[model samples]
Each structure stands twice: as C-alpha cells, then as structure tokens.
Target: MSHVRVAIPKKGFERFEKYNPENLKSFEQLIEEQNGDTYCLKLNMHLLRMYNAYPQLVNLKITRLILLKALSKLPYQHFNFARKYLIWSQLIDDGIRVIIDMADLLENEDYEEFWMHYKQKATILPILDGFDEAIRKYICFKVGSTRTTVPCMEFKMKLAVDKEVLMKYITQLGWMINGNEVKVFPLMLNDSNDRDVIRGIICSDIR
Candidate 1:
C-alpha cells in the first residue's frame, strides 16, 4: 500500500521541548493547529518522552490529548498511526495496543469487536468526549450509503446504541422507520442535470 510522507517540523519540536505547566496551554494550542497531520504523531511521541522524563506530568488530560491526536489520524493513516506508537510501550501502557486493535476493527467495519474493546478498556484513559457519536456517524454513513434499507435491529447493532438513540440518529438523517426496517435515501446531488441523469439510469436499470 502507498503512504504519504509528511515532513515533521523541527522548529515545532524545539518549541515543544520547553513545554511545562506554565506553557502547557499554549503548547496544546500549537499541537491542535497541527492536528490531522503526521507532525501530530511526532508531537505525541514527544509527549510520551516528556511523560517518561517526568512521570508526574502524566495525567488524564495528557493521555486524552495523546489519544485524540492518534484518533485524528484514523481517516488518513488508519491503524498505522496506533502501531507507530507501540515502540514506546515500555514507557506507556497497553492503551496503545488496545487503540491499535480497536482502530483495526473499525477500519474493517467490525463494529461489534470495536465496541467490545472500547467498553473493556475505555477507562484506561480519560473519557473521549463524542467518541460514540463519531463512530455512529461513520456507521450511518457507511451503511446508509450502500444499503437502501437495513433491519432496525442490525442498524442498532452496527451503531452499538439503543433503539431510542438509533431513532434519533436516523430521524436526523431524514430516514423513515417502517416496522423492523429503516429506509435510507441516496446522497443528494447538487447539480439538477446530473441528478436527473443518474435517476433516469437507476429507474431504467430497475425496470
């Protein structure tokens, strides 16, 4: 598989080395600006090094920051981002391994296994706000885009949420619930001409 190589900024690391309680807020802002880039991965590694140097600096906030940065890479790097951090296991904990496994499951669309791991190990670090909601959005997008209709029970299982919550999500997407199934509309097309042509082809194929 091909991968994009992102150049890490040396100046960023130089500035990161000066991070302390006094400047942590600013440091966080700098890193957040670099989110979704490979530079964030390097920053996370630097954070692990700092934690190793001063174990007292390790806290829920720090761990959550690292985990969030790792998660931000999921769309581009998938589990590879998690795996890159495994070399520091002696300094950290098994949380990296758990994240790697969970990421792999999610990438493979194995929502059941992902939830099992999430529920089992979520307490290892700080609670990731909106984690479930983000995963649910991905599930809805993936299943809804492909399937015109899905069994309500199956959709609930895929989202790993209760019926009430599922209803809210589907309703927000403008889907209709009929007995045991939920209807999913195709994605909207912005261009009316293209939309008409696509609809005609679909109708002809169905007929």
Candidate 2:
C-alpha cells in the first residue's frame, strides 16, 4: 500500500479520541508532524472537530488519496494543476453515479466477485465520491440482509468512547490547541520499508 501523509487539526484529534481511544494516537501523531502550512489547507479547528465527530458522513480521505495518487508522480509544483483538472474531473464523474445508487444493482453473489476483482487490481480503495455510501451498503449486504448492526454507527459508538478518553488524557497531558487555526505542511515519506517507524510515530501522543 502506498502511504500518504495527512495533517489533521486539533479538533480532529479531539474527535478521533472521542470515537475510539484504542491506539488512537496511532494516526494522530502522523498528522501532527506535518508542516501545518502545506496540508491543513483551509480547515479550522472547529470544522476539524465537526468532521471528526461524524467522519463517516463528512470525511474526504478518499478524495485526498485520489489527488495524492495522481500527483505523487508529478513534481510538487504541478500539484495545483492536478488538483484543478484530474482530481476535480474524477470527482465529478464518480459523484454522479454515486456508490449508494449502484449498490442496489448488485446481487449478493456479485459482491464477492467484485471484491475479489478490485482487491486483485489493488484498486479496492480508490477514490470514489460516495465511498462511504458504497461501503455501508456493501457491509450491510455482507453481514446478511437480516442483520441490523450498522457498521458505520457501531464504529462511531466505539470511536465516541475512545475519543472521550483520549480528550481527557490529552488535556491532562497538556496537548491543547493554542489558537483558532493551525497551518499544515506536506511531509514526504521517502521510503516504503519504514512501516514500523510510521506506525510508532503515529501511535505517539504530541506533548
């Protein structure tokens, strides 16, 4: 898997902690080390909190991944061009069909075939505008039609507990935000073999 660095806001951290405390820092510290000027974009602490609290609905990581993949092969200066043309173009096309709408078209047996094909292609996680919708529908189908446990909801509930505990821990640990906004910057992961380092860094809390 190609790893891309992402910067999340303080509020986003709070939300992540609120949702699932277990290994919560596993992803948080990864975002913190990023230079704020490059990646934070226009997001604020308030919006970060809101997005984190209900990530299944408001998250845009898929889009982020898509843009990153297309630009990763280009020079850094070309990112703006890629974002304007390739990313937005792909987003428009994907959004129109919408994954939720397409989910109804597949039979139970078709999912396995589709899953296998996508996984083999390594395109299973590609950028799809309605990815959340598609994932929800697929999970529902996978667990059998009669099952009522919503995976998204279950995730949120677990996340909420974790988030709450993380917040308390961070506060006690003095990892509070100092302002309304923070700048974010990009950090390149030069090698693919450093999974252990990546995992360790993310799992650590910022002091």
Best by TM-score: 1
Model 2 lDDT per residue over 21-120, tens place:
3332334334333332334322222223333444443334433443333222222222242233222234444432232122222333344443444345
In model 2, how large is the Cα lDDT of residue 37? 36
Q: Against the correct fold, how does model 2 do in TM-score? A: 0.21
Q: lDDT of candidate 2 vs native? A: 0.34
Model 1 residue pairs with clashes: none
Expressed as tens digits, the lDDT of each residue in 50-107 for candidate 1 is 5555556554355555665555433434234334433343334566556656777877
Candidate 1 residue spans exceeding 4 A from truth: 1-64, 72-86, 90-92, 186-207
TM-score, prediction 1: 0.58
Q: Candidate 1 lDDT (Cα, whole model)?
A: 0.60
lDDT of 1 at 203: 50
